[model samples]
Target: MTPETVIGFARSAIEITLLLSLPMLAVSLVVGVVLSVLQAATQIQEMTLTFVPKLVAMFIAIILAFPWLMDKMVGFTRDILLNLPKYIQ
Candidate 1:
């Protein structure tokens, strides 16, 4: 493959990675911020208070988004596999 093709594939791989990670990351971020605010307000600064909720929220988010995430991953893998010959040439 040409340098340009290699770069394009690398760029696409990065983009796909970022796209797949954004939802869970965003959910975690929001949950963390909200938990922070709650801790600040209530003066309940327990470590588990923060850890448990964020973990649960992230777990729920992953469960809810599993289908879409799987679809994107499968599609990307299928595209790469199907086009393997083109890349090999």
Candidate 2:
């Protein structure tokens, strides 16, 4: 493949990765911020306090978003597979 094609593929891969990860990351970030605020307000300050909630929230988010995530990944894989001949040429 040409340099432009290579770069385009790289960019697409990175974009897909970010798109797939953003939801979970955003959820975790929001949960962490909220937990921090609660801890501050309640003066709990327990190190493990945030872990369970964040884990649970992330797990829930993943479960909720699994279908969409799978669709995106499958589509990406299909596109790459279908375009394999073009890359080979």
Clash-forming residue pairs, model 1: none
lDDT of 2 by residue, 1-89 (tens): 99999999999999999999998999999999999999999999897899999999999999999999999999999999999999989
Instruction: List ranges where model 1 is wrong by over 4 Å.
Output: none
**Each candidate: RMSD to true structure?**
0.8, 0.6
lDDT of each: 0.94, 0.96
In model 1, the Cα lDDT at residue 65 comes to 93
Per-residue lDDT over 6-42 for candidate 1, one digit per residue giving the tens place of the 0 to 100 score: 9999999999999999988999899999999999999
* TM-scores for the candidates: 0.95, 0.97
Point to the candidate with the largest TM-score: 2
Model 1: how far residue 21 lies from native, Å: 0.8
Minimum summed lDDT over a 10-residue window in model 2 is located at 45-54
Alpha carbon lDDT of residue 86, candidate 1?
92
Candidate 2 residue pairs in clash (backbone atoms < 3 Å): none
What candidate 2 gets wrong by more than 4 Å, as runs, is none
